[model samples]
Target: MLTAAIGTWKLVTGRADKLFAGASEERLYTELAPGKNRLIYLWGHLTAVHDRMLPLLGLGPRLHPELDAIFLTAPDKTVAELPSTADLTSAWAGVNAALLAGFDSLTPAQWLERHADVSPEDFAREPHRNRLAILLNRTNHTSFHLGQAVLAPK
Candidate 1:
């Protein structure tokens, strides 16, 4: 399970890394059409969520708590200011590094354990909702948003 989980993560992150490897700060704000979210928002949102996952899995704290307001939980098109692309990139990379490190510490048992907000009793009742499940859900979400990124005009 560990091997499979890490392998899946590697593939997904690899694809994401390639996609954003050449993304400039200016390009990060490009949208597929008017009123759509900027690429930076999506990227920052991804970073923020990944940061959240760390603590959810009993890993560590969020690298950018400040982003939670703008990236996580905030409704789309909500009027607000955002951080610079470079700052977000730093947070994104740092969170991913810490997440990978945390993954290395988890055994298969840990993967099956309950995640944040979901109590042990609830996790027992909903067997499918575990730490690994959270990762799977987040990974799927990232892939979905990646499609949006691909469609945005370069």
Candidate 2:
């Protein structure tokens, strides 16, 4: 489980780095549509997935609770008010590093422990599957959005 988690996190961080490489500050905030900004879209999706997975893994919310209140606003929010593409990329890198560290510290037995509150409808086959499952899903999810974000017009 530890090996799988580390591998998945490395892949995720690599993809995120590739996604933002050479992107200009102007490009980060550019909206493809009116009232539909790129930073907000990407950050919101990332936050939402993290919010879901963190609780399952017994981690605190990714961002502060007060910040979440702000993000709950209609248009969503940028990554911690990052005003430039470079800043945004740096922010993502920080998040990736933290996730990598957290995943690396988990033991195999901890990964397999069942969550008592998991519902039958959850996609995970059992309440106590490998914690790597969450990391894998998050990595895949981020990759999908990063692709979309790249393709989106500035």
TM-scores of all predicted structures: 0.91, 0.64
Worst window of 10 by summed lDDT in candidate 1: 75-84
> How would you encode candidate 2's per-residue C-alpha lDDT over 52-122 as one tens digit per residue?
55556665446423324434444554345533444444555555555556666667777766542465456
Candidate closest to the true structure, highest lDDT: 1
Model 1 over residues 51-91: C-alpha lDDT tens digits?
A: 88988999987777887888878855684678766676688
Off by over 4 Å in 1: 76-80
Model 1: clashing residue pairs? none
Regions of candidate 2 where Cα sits further than 4 Å from its true position: 32-40, 51-55, 59-63, 66-73, 76-91, 115-125, 128-130
